[model samples]
Target: MDKTAGEYHFTRLETVVFGAGKVESLGRELSRRGSNRALIVTGKTLGRSKLLDKVKSAAGSALAGVFTGAEQHVPSHTVNELVAEARRVGADSMVSFGGGSPIDTVKNAAWQLMGGRAGSRTIDFSAGAAESGRGGDILHIAIPTTLSAGEFTPGGGVTNESTKVKGGVADPRLQAKVVILDPALTIETPAWLWASTGMRALDHAVEGSYSTRHQLVTDTLATKAIELLNAHLLPSLQMHGDDELEHRMRCQLAAWLSIFGMSNTRGGISHALGHQIGPMWNVPHGVTSCITLPHVMRFMAEVAADRFGPIAQGFDLRFDPRSPRSSAVECADRIAKFIGKFEVPTRLRDVGVPREEISRIAGTVLEEVKRANTVGVEVTLEQLVGILDAAY
Candidate 1:
């Protein structure tokens, strides 16, 4: 099918709630999704926080057990542990609490329960019709505290502890059945982390907008997502009072909308670079976007310049379709300036990737480009290194 003429399939995601204290309705929401027993999956810090208590209280009789073992990057071993725990507790559903890591950890667990294996490259995120029935009965609920919006997507990447390499699974049925976007829970997030993740969401909007598989449905959603994130992210970073809660809510909504197009689009240049460099260097996913997104935009502009019009327009910049390449570069500059205002690291070196390792990292990224159908760009090792060097 042509870009404008492609089909869109609704994911298995069924219910969502958004507000300050909407988490208090977790039990009711669980009922809405036809779930009763839930296993809470989260990291250590939040495992000890009052938010956990709040969620547990809200879960009440529905809570089966808690797994506080979620680590960054959804380590493969953790996925196993979570799987064993979910089975032991007889959990019919999983609740993901925290940012992308724990959310993805739960996704991996659901994937496993539904017969997916960690580190299995043979399993596509959109495993087609024959395998479509696998995860349909396995439910997951997400209560996100950061903007790394893994909860909304069916894909979840897991890293090998020994090799620091990443692999992932995606099946539409594995997407969270219910998502509760509680800005009240997000007030505890560290500012830099929140800001960096907002950039990650922005990356989603920008990437989806210019995707080669771009569709009218996704373009419209991506446009609104970009506009919402562009308007609210910076202000949401420094929450001061009740009014800021609404900004944070907008951010949460935008995060949900940003990756709405992923199912229909190929992974972009930014994602290919970020996917490798992130786990390889222990850089957080959000920080990877801060460093690589603008450079990837500029690099991809050669053939896809006109596709950037929505991105520039999202940033409230003037877009001249007559001068598409220049407009694309201008959009890149504006994105960089927006990222700079967050005071997060804007270079690979700043994020602790050694200067001497650029070539090695580039080789790894090229392999990722080959592995995923990313952006349709024939990226060479030299071009990859050039992008890294520029970011460095």
Candidate 2:
């Protein structure tokens, strides 16, 4: 897999403070960025958690205000409210708390916050150029408690509230200036959520390694992430052990590695399908990965089987060089088995998705496939429904 001629792109993230109790540095991090007024944004339930209180205490006087309007799926209306709140409080920077939803909420709002005049620094996707402008961007700090790795990337998925179609924004300027990966902050995250999001990170690693745009650097990072998550994700949920925090920290590092080079390599069909399925059915993105990733991998194996060897190897399974298709199937089976170890819903039916919705989901995914044109493989509606049926 040595490719001599490929570009390696990096995001705008600068600092990552990793370890226990690192959230204590939030105020200092804001000071280093020269931000006087920062708004704290998170989802509704976390606002009532003791974790938010820790964030507030650490942010101290630098926090201008709190906005808890961040919802699952990142609705456009909620982003609009966050934009107004950011402006209303005269914020110089923002802090995203909780999981993917809040992190993406701040990222999508950055376009409107920057007013398109400052983003001349440019975006990989042309959409950012139209919506976010060029340059003069104010970056935010991301303190994630879940293993969902959206904070590591510049792009974010935004759901259209009226239609519930998930769209996105990809401006490098919207990338977090700083990411705090403190295990202490994640202690309160539910075990099921942690395990499921760990699968989401694993999906990142799997999809990144075989993506059409895969490069040497990302393959190294992504495969290592796969191994680390396999080894540490479940241990992070230890009911009684001093090792739990350490394991959680390792999982956090794995999550970051999973998406380190996302600017250059977007995930393939598993993610594309999940992007649509997650918002429409109100399933969490991680749970959607549980439902779709293995089936998607099996479907992609005919064309992309050779790429599955490393993933199988990551999970300590034997990968046959002579039989790449079977090896890919084994890899997919390993992933499914790992996901089953957790309590999260593993089938579309388990998550309340009706059998009647498979056609609708397939149609929506087909429309997305037509629009993106980079699924790494051509897929038809029948194949999608077949995969959905297997998951169902």
- After superposition, candidate 2 runs with Cα above 4 Å error: 1-3, 116-135, 370-375
Give the CA lDDT, 0 to 100, for residue 72 in model 1.
Answer: 84
lDDT of each: 0.82, 0.83
Cα lDDT, model 1, residue 359:
76
Candidate 2 lDDT over residue span 203-301, tens digit each: 998887777777778888888899999889887886445588899999999999998866676667787788888888899999989989998888877
Report the C-alpha lDDT of model 1 over 47-152, residue by residue, as the tens digit: 9898899999999788999999999877789999999999999999888999999998988888778876567532245552124464456778899999988888
Rate residue 239 of model 1 by lDDT: 56
With candidate 2 superimposed using the best TM-score fit, by how many Å does residue 214's alpha carbon deviate from the native? 1.1
TM-scores of the candidates in the order shown: 0.95, 0.93
lDDT of 1 at 328: 90
Which candidate has the top score in TM-score? Answer: 1
